[model samples]
Target: MLVALLLLVLALSNEVRVNGERGGRQCGANPSLKPRPHSVSILEFGAVGDGKTLNTLAFQNAIFYLKSFADKGGAQLYVPPGTWLTQSFNLTSHLTLFLEKGAVIIGSQDSHHWDVVDPLPSYGRGLEVPGGRYQSLINGYKLQDVVITGNNGTIDGMGLTWWESFRSHSLNYSRPHLVEFVASNDVVVSNLTFLNAPAYNIHPVYCSNVHIHNISIFAPPESPYTVGIVPDSSDNVCIEDCTIATGYDAIALKSGWDEYGIAYGRPTENVHIRRVHLQASYGSTLAFGSDMSGGISNVVVEDAHLYNSKGGIEFRTTRGRGGYMKEIIISDVEMKNIDTAISATGYCGSHPDDKFDPNALPLLDHFILQDMIGTNITIAGSFAGLQESPFTNICLSNITLSVNYASSTTWNCSNVFGFSDSVFPKPCSDLDNPSNYSSSYLSMLSMKGKTMVSGSVSMKK
Candidate 1:
């Protein structure tokens, strides 16, 4: 069963209620749902909700017609109870795509059905391949005031064929995401269930004011590279009350990749993630880059439950990745049956291209992880900062992880500096000294650019 259905089985109302508005948790900007002045049903556009019918033309025609209402208080396109098969479609600004109860939007299984689009500016090339990538099932570009909500309607990506092709190396382009929003603002994706995404489910890139609340995301335990929610190169984001289980990172924050991301110079910041139950069979519950060339900072993640996962939280990047990840706080987290509770490594990713400067080094600083409790953890943490550019000001407080390490060190450290207090299992002696922070800061300030740097739990089981 999808975790979203099991976790959200109790709340069956057809209303938008953010945790903040309900008067319990105040973690994100409150974005309300105002009813659209004009509403149209998909049925009127000749869209048959039968699972076998392909309604690609119907969606495109409907959106084209709805674009005229952009100035007329926007509009709503209601999808009633049925499985609507689509190839790919674009969304208009100031529009609401509401899926009613038992409504489903399934992606076409044929790879050729998806549109081929150019790669993102920050990525320079396709994520998995060198050529252009396929467009997401639902795409929005340079729009505003878009909302994708429903009474827990499901968006199913029949991704088995895509995954099979990827594994066989027969794919020509990178797989398409389930839904993607690019360079948009005031976006809201709530009260929905996303399943079996080909790659990522709900990817908001180069966007702002994105609110993703009260949603469920699930992929099979064996699915490959199926991430839940990825907020890339965007800011002012809120993700709460979500239950996600996948093969990869439940929630991954990324900016750009290698020199391409460095050239883009856009960082992902001002994000709030809370009250999320995340699980990953082959990746971290929450991750930050392996492609963070555009920087990721000022992120707050709290009140999360990470259980039965391979890794809890990880920060991943490598040399030739010129970016910074700092000013982050992760608190009030509980972890169970995790392989690695926390980890940050400098040598953990591949470069996008050979043109990337081998000297571009990343900066990791000012990270605080506290108020965390874990049980049945194999490794507490493993911090491997770069020798040339060491990670600094890492503060760990009020953290307790029950780990049974027979001979290996509970916490592995290499060229990393931090301070630890009120932590069980006895962290490395390097973290005991807060005095090293000054030297590391001075070292970073004195150095210039272009320096040479050296670098889940299965749910079914």
Candidate 2:
């Protein structure tokens, strides 16, 4: 009996190790690429954490050393407990930037000191304006096996200046994010607290095999355009167990903008988002597009909670933005105090310019929402497709939502085709009757937990 117990313990340990390595493997990182035995604190590079001194050069010199050490098995740059004031700094590959508890990295308020990068090829211009974009507080490019984790350390972007400039239409370029990884692969960002980003909090663009978990992100509800996490034109990404309270969408997926995006066709695919708590002051909990002309597919959002958000699950695209969005699955969601429980519109936001082709209509199909519950919602569901190209093959089952007493409780659907079963507020006539659904249709709906995209992808749960 004792021998059997020992064997069982060994088996359990092996299982835990395997599970932990799954993320590392997906990110192209392995134990063999571990950081060198040497660890250096920022103080060693003459960094002063008095919260007033400029530490940009110190950070730069330290990262330069680590970059040179990349061939020497990499290195770890440690940020000790204090407020470190610095401008944007580039990160090196095969390195770890670990922040101790109580450590804070504060972005410098001087805008002129920030670095500027060219606009994205897919956007043809900055997303907000028509010029270059300011680099993020912690920016990386074309890196591999990079990890940013800490004991819930804070990275604060002093964005009030940028916000004022935007509201007053005095900005020449787009604001910077709190953290951004561009053209990077095998990245992991976890256990950090992000606050007051000028634009998006976390953005990973043109990257693949990224993992983000156990992070808390926040910004003032009144702050404009402060999105939480945006994965753009990337693949094989996973985001789990995070809390996001921001001004815009808690999590927005994107590929590219209008005509420029169609020319540079790189789609965002195979993303998994689970166990997320989303709160938005002015936007949706989970959103896609408003700028997705490069296409987005095979996304699974499950086990999410939303509070005081404008929309719960939303998809937005306009006539001039041509993209295909399909195979999206949302399951086991609970929402409270939301304006709209579900929304899909093809004419929500405006185009970048009149030069865009009006014939570039979006295509949407194979959307499924299941096992959802909502309370104090303004509208149970509002789905509006384009008159020229209607949405198709939407499915909803096992949904129960309560409309606010002061609001009309109804499901408004137009220019879409789909079916519903055991759904509240009764779906529109475009959907087939629940009783008339075939057994195969029922079986497909029942397979919600097994596969999010018809055997293409499986989530870790």
Candidate 3:
């Protein structure tokens, strides 16, 4: 009777597991939980959450049904608790994909199932390589009022196979991102967890009015090209109250790639990033560009914290990148154990091809950094502009840093025109005396304070 007793115990355990999954369907009170007249459950579409069943057709049918009811206030697709394996699926306008707690949408590992899409017009090719790109797990294109939020549910990209292919140099097309919104407008992605993205976590390209907050993006420290959130060629974007720990830049703002981008001429502007906590083992806490050719302007980054990151507040663009980065403001930043506190370099990464124009020099101007504090910094700051096109109107104020390395070199400035006040370890002579322009400098300080306060209020909403 010993064997019979063991079998009874096993059956009881399975019953408990099933009961737990059924009971914990709701995580917390979601704002989108208001009674919807047109709501459907994925279970009704024969989606088995046994963690092994391929639910691609189930998801497709559900989305098709929702699309049919688009004019009637759309539909809400509820994903219950379990691991639902599915391939890439297109998103619909005015549709809400809500996942209950313990529910996970797992990306299919088979590359044959993914759809390949054409390259972006501004990029001219895939971001990492030429030719087309594989679609993201959750793809939305030219849609309006899309909402991808849930009660802390997860969208897991089982990226080991893709990452292995990239490292082995056997990739023909570009790897897929976790969630991408292409040419869409009025998007909201919040209250979710993204893990093990194949490349970038969240990429919103050529979109407008995007709001990303209350999320956590994570990957292993050794994962390559796993950037956190990228707002590429988008405008009026706000990212706040997020914790990002990734292998690449926690937030990399881009416009486009090289000469192809110059012809497109769509600039990314009016971006506000605040209250972000970043942890990076291999990349920057905040990186502007290595591929900014469509121009990036009117960006503000404030009230950020970085821990053990490789770099901090970096602005990088190569020679062929003809974009202009201006009117950027950074304030109230605290960093610890960072390699480089601040950097603005004209040369950072390589161009897409040799056909890129050598005469295209990026313009960097009107950059201000104030009230910055850091500890255990390897290098205080490095600002190097192109000799032919010097950076103009840069300013630094109320900076305090403690260098860990025992080196005579504290600050390196070249081909830049700016001023510094109350800066530690001294500043390069390229910066003029602040007393010479006290009136305008004081006005700038006042403006910075106002911007910071206003940004905080706006970000909370």
Q: Name the best candidate (by lDDT).
A: 1
Model 2: CA > 4 A from native = 1-36, 433-461
What value does the lDDT take at residue 105 in candidate 2?
95
> Comparing candidate 1 with candidate 2, which one achieves the higher lDDT?
1
TM-score of each: 0.89, 0.89, 0.88
Clashes of 2: 0
lDDT, candidate 2, at 262? 85
How far residue 96's Cα lies from its native spot in candidate 2, in Å, is 1.0
CA deviation > 4 Å runs, candidate 3: 1-36, 435-461
**Residue pairs with backbone overlap in model 2:** none
RMSD versus native structure for model 1: 9.9
Return the lDDT, model 1, position 229: 95
Clashing pairs in 1: 281-456, 282-456, 309-457, 310-456, 310-457, 347-455
Q: Pick the candidate with the highest TM-score.
A: 1
For 248-271, candidate 1 gives per-residue lDDT tens digits of 899999999999999999999777
lDDT of 3: 0.80
